[model samples]
Target: MKIRRLASQIVLPILMVASTPALLHAAPLEPTRGGEGGRIIRVTTLAKDGPGSLKAAVEAKGKRIIVFEVGGVIDLQRTILNIDEPFLTIAGQTAPSPGITIVRGGIDLKGHDVKISHIRVMTGVDGQAKLSGWEADAFSTVAAHNVIVEHCSFFWAIDENMSTSGPRFNGKTVKEWRAATSHDVLFRENLAAEGLADASHPKGEHSKGTLIHDNATGITLYRNVYAHNMERSPLVKGGAQVLMVNNMIFDPGHRAVHYNLMNLEWAGHDYVTGEITAVGNVMRAGNSTAPGLPFLTLGGDGDLAWYSKDNINVDRWGNPAPMFGRYGVTKAKLIEKDSPMASLGGLDVMPAKDLETSLLASVGARPWDRAPDDIRVLFFVAEGRGEIIDDEKVVGGYPHPSPTAAPFVDKDWNLKTMEPKSGVYPGQKGGAQEKLSARDEAMRENAK
Candidate 1:
């Protein structure tokens, strides 16, 4: 009996020690799970094209996971990559130093099941004068589906910073093609700033933040911030199931939330119709916007379920605005949960101070990629520094002035000089290239 007891005790201790590591390792953090258990691809350069470049890394075909070895600016130099692969993950959080930044060029994701996090993409030009204001957005998708874009910052584009659309399919623009091309898109904890005004639009103040085109669905914009822009703080058209919860809009030039019913230019030809539900959002209007600038640009055909529960809106004086919208109901005390879209509602609406603080700390290219100057010139206007100037100082900027932040860019929407030390670091060639190894060993993961 003594020998048996001794053996049992010894075996039990050994088993406990052996199983502890396995158990601890099994519960990885949520950030590590973003790859969705796909083949990992490690990127080692900021090159625009070719091997070790972001373009090539994204262009490669597979259920791939991409991690950055170096954190620097990838100057596309007027080039834009059209991503056509499905089940891809661009894990910007893997960058040890600064994270990845894409400038001049943009990524047009036209695939499915893609996830991107903790990255920055910027188009330098202010407006569409260059490239006719088309194909030049920080991140755009045409017929892309199930995309999760989180913890990213987009700004300084001639058009909307981040947008989803239904491109021409089978040489025709139809509902079926539009539906298949884009759906189930999510944007969380992101920043969309400084949209350039379009030359031709009704308001003439035609900058866009999140422009959802016809034929999109399950488009969720959660806990996002839009700053220093004109119209289209998510201009939606074409029928889609949209949930915008816990978002913040600061110092916009015009009204937010313009819902188009494909009634205007596209009209009958290519109109987007969808359900829109906005709740627990914060809108702060500085001196830049009109005194009575509304929170929503009413007028759409899609089903809309509007709840104003637990929202914070302040005017230029930092006074809580009584009305949330110029068109819809002003103050909503309690969100009606009896609707069918209860899950889309915000669980807890964050206060303005908390939301602002959260954005200031969490937005952009994570903590590592931020330069000292990034805060001073990150969004449309430097947050505290770019307070609204006198409206009369700028034209068409009637009660408020236009945006005043962001580095000067060339006409082609490219920054004239990408200072390595300022924005994303520019790694010197032949330097000890940092290597972000592919974590998925089950699949053949190799870096070229």
Candidate 2:
């Protein structure tokens, strides 16, 4: 309760300035059904705030769905946009041509029942010196719940590309910790890549992918692409429950999937074990990957409840690698299980053998309208290229997506999934495919 109270105090001032979140008249539905049948809010500007901007729409509240009438980069001006309202849907699929890309800032979810899809976020260095402490996550949940994030692209973050965070020990009991922290979250079919290693983070060397922070519960990551991040693809801490299925990890530094519980953080509290269920996942070593790194590593001071099935680990040359390793200095315990305690009933859990082929074609935000950066990242994943960079400028920096705009016709889309009813996504023709072809042609010319 103290943690919750502290969070309220910090957020209340922001809410007071932005106006308190409006309560939606409709009852909240499941995470997948976020903002269904709510008012449609159109974002028509690239401004960080004010009318017709994303920050304004999110701060306005109610069960609302955001559709972009403009397509371009929204320079957040190095400010993290906080979503502290519930029952919201951010439908980036509605953007015209090359879709919405948020640059120089990050999204912080502090609300419940939110669904975000088809968006790209690039939180770069913003002219900060290396290790100068200007860290940011492309997207993160702060004690938020019932959230679903899919078909998004995250890059160049100084901190973890995407993560779930809350208090480590909210109360005296494990149940209280579970209740107070972020829960029932899902991230699928996204690309988390190129986290800036040794960038603006104060600690330095913080190029991470996804981190399910301590006490977060019921988190599921399915069919996502994790490429070029140094580590944490991803790390699950103590008192958390996570299910990772059919995800692809490429070029992780020393870790791929790991579990840890720091004793210093839980000094006064009793140790609450973490649970992980990994199925049909694939990890391929690349140029930046540490030699002889295992697919999954167990570390830290506490024990872990783990279940792994049919996962694949291999080097770039197709040589098989270690499946598991122990990296903790402490004599930590491992509780291996015959079956997964968490269920993946609704997930389309595919085989590890077919993961790379399946993900390469359709990963990241607006796969049909992919910017050049997304294309390059996917290409690098396929070719076993690219290294962990300390800065975003190493890979051409932030792209300049051509600005375009068009009316958003609600009848043309399936509101629930935010997919086009006609089965033709924007920029599907004469766009991303052409860029890919051009890139290939240039590569061939260079080979000569």
Candidate 3:
């Protein structure tokens, strides 16, 4: 099958002219007065006490609007002190330096209406063993409602060997622990990439009530991408109620999308009743050393397990086909153009009445719908060449660039979901004759 390739590049310039004054002068967002109205505060320093200064300014202003105006690097070694009020807006400069990296003691939020934009919250680490003070986690939230975390990045590093071997690989060491718990949170147009080492620690964790809308959620993950992410499986113990759409999740280690029952308890306790909708996502699995199954469903074992389908699809070769342990999918369908998933009985879930109505009323197509099945999807490898190859072929063809390369696919084909199946529910079985009849009809139609 032909694989679809997309070239990943840093498009924005690293440096740009400072325009804080101009932005401030242009137009204010309807400034409010006193506690009832919101005020704007700018933080433009790179001191270890930068967060302290910012917090003081916010308190002094007595307004909720707080902007991180510092254009240069601000080392966040516990910079953000506390976030107690609502209607807070923290915006950074457009230019990029080291950006804002919070190590330990992230921002704790209370109330609602918090907005953060144009910043990179990275965890700086020295080596796999010696984590930088920032690797502890740059920013965290707690009981914050209607929060918006947009146009930002979250990164960390991990040990290469330790991630693959030891208890970490078995998904035991990585536990679910978020610095914060946000409701109605929006994480849009951001990038969550892996640092130098395996940065997949703190795995098997969940971020509740998060809307991962239109972002490069997981990009450039070399070694342990979601190896031990407890949050990976929404039905699992650490899993949370998350709306993940229009994102790219690439894992060179284990399955890119892992659903485990171990993390589902948290969902029940938190009263999170939303199902994980893996729609319009691009997931690329690891190469040689990497397991073929790019997606795995652990726990939820037997007949009571959960499954994914409907508008939810996967590439045939790059990742292993979806695996079901005990649970099964409900009203789910999988599709792939010229791939195995395509042949698997399923139907398209898009172009529904609701989707068309929403698209017509919106400003434009939803970010997640950019590469809709109707659009032409393209893939470009680092080598600047395009070809279809199996996992083994792709891995063998490209010399492992780094030990990390052991998990990423270098040369591979590109495939798209075409002619999505129509109206098929999960957990239903069909006889071989029925399957053959359907295939024959599709073939005849295509021939015509």
Candidate 4:
């Protein structure tokens, strides 16, 4: 599990640099042009909310792209930043070295057509009492659509680290429920880890990962890293259509990926069977993981129609682990299929064996300027040394990097995607360096 090469040294997929037509065709799961022809709005200060604050820029009227002139943590004072405006793009990559980090709070995406990348969200306990009902997700989409969240780091959330969810039963019909909830969203190449257990959540010891709430549709989680969290690396609830592809989950407490639909929650509405397509995923046990924990756990009163293929589940010693389990009083039906109902026709999905190498090299925000906490977490995953924690204090709490600011030059980047037109990113010295392909890497390894 050791990452033999640095992230910058690995050859990333084309999606990392530019979008292709195939990638774009990944809809209704793919995100649309988010704030792509919008006016540029610069966040010139690190204030929580003011004239030049990130909050102000997000709350601004009309379609806009929010770029940062300052770098460092923006302490929300335990408050959440709600993005209620639509068609917004937050280009955190435009920030100076050691890119933008939001701490002591979270971001709630309630708007449609939003794209955010290269940002870190570290929501610690903020001195709140344990089991006192204080909870926050590092990032979440609430009944929003056409959104993309990439290359972000989420840590220390009292609830799920990152999630796409909304009102479970928004309308009487399943189609209405799907429309009203979060859907058509993409979460790619992010790191979701170290949720705080037994700290501030009212439900004691609740340190989950991601929760795709009931009835949400067209959700795709691709190439993300989920580590050191208790469970729900994502839990797909009833009637949701989800595609979990090429993701890595390490050190889960009790479960890795699961599905459940409690009878009480869907008392009035009939239970619609959920659909899950899990492909090319890797789940490894770690220190805090439960013994003999199944890679996919099915629970509750209803059944789930799932398809799993090319997924690897192993224990700490690299021993093979169980693949499936059930956890409810009633005998819930488990529908296993040979092929998926829906196809990831346009996305690039690698084999499970190649997943760790790609993930270790690219997951998380600002790989070129990773925070010490993120660096440690990634290293721990490589060396297999970290564990699920009860508090963020165990890992030195939130960071307070000395704030740095620099002027942004809009001409240097493509305003639509915020990518550098000159092929040189912020932290790079010159043109992008050459990367080793998989074959070349394998040859080098053999030589060693």
Model 1, runs deviating above 4 Å? 1-35, 126-135, 167-178, 198-206, 265-273, 300-305, 322-342, 345-353, 372-374, 377-448
lDDT of 3 by residue, 39-84 (tens): 4454555454635345564444344544443333344443345666
Model 2 lDDT on a 0 to 1 scale: 0.82
- Each model's Cα RMSD: 15.4, 9.7, 18.6, 6.4
Q: TM-scores of the models, in the given order?
A: 0.69, 0.90, 0.47, 0.90
Sort order, lDDT high to low: 4, 2, 1, 3
Residues 1-448, candidate 1: write the lDDT tens digits.
0101111112221111111110001121111223366665767767788887778888888777776666667777767778888877786655544456776767788888887877777665423343343446678878787777876877665557788877533336555655675777877767787665543233344466888876577787866778767767788765555677768887777677766553444444643335567667778785457677767655644334444455666777677664534344422122234443525432334554555544444454453335322343333332433432212113221111121112222232111111222333222122111222357442435532
Q: What digit string (tens of lDDT, one per residue) describes model 2 on residues 1-448?
A: 0101111112221111111111111122224567888999999998899999999999876899999999999999889999999989998888897899999999999999898888999999977997788899999999999998877999999898989998777776888888898998988778999999888899989999999999898898877899988889999998789988889999998789998988878788778888999999999999999999999888888888889999999988989999889886796788999999787665556678866776776667876566788878887887789988888888888878778889999898777656677767666543224344678899978999
Best by lDDT: 4
Candidate 4: regions farther than 4 A off: 1-29, 429-448
CA lDDT, candidate 4, residue 27:
37
- Whole-model lDDT values for every prediction: 0.57, 0.82, 0.30, 0.83
Q: Count the backbone clashes (under 3 Å) in each candidate.
A: 10, 0, 46, 0
TM-score of 2: 0.90
Per-residue accuracy of model 4 over 1-448 as CA lDDT, tens digit each: 2212223424554113212101111233456678888999999999999899999999987889999889998999989999999989888888987789999999999999998888999998877898887899999999999999988999999898999989987777788889999998889889999998888898889788999999998888988999999989999898888999889999999888999988889888888999999999999999999999999998988789889889999999999999998787775788988898666765677789877866776778876556778778877887888998888888888898889988889888777557767655565432222345699889979999
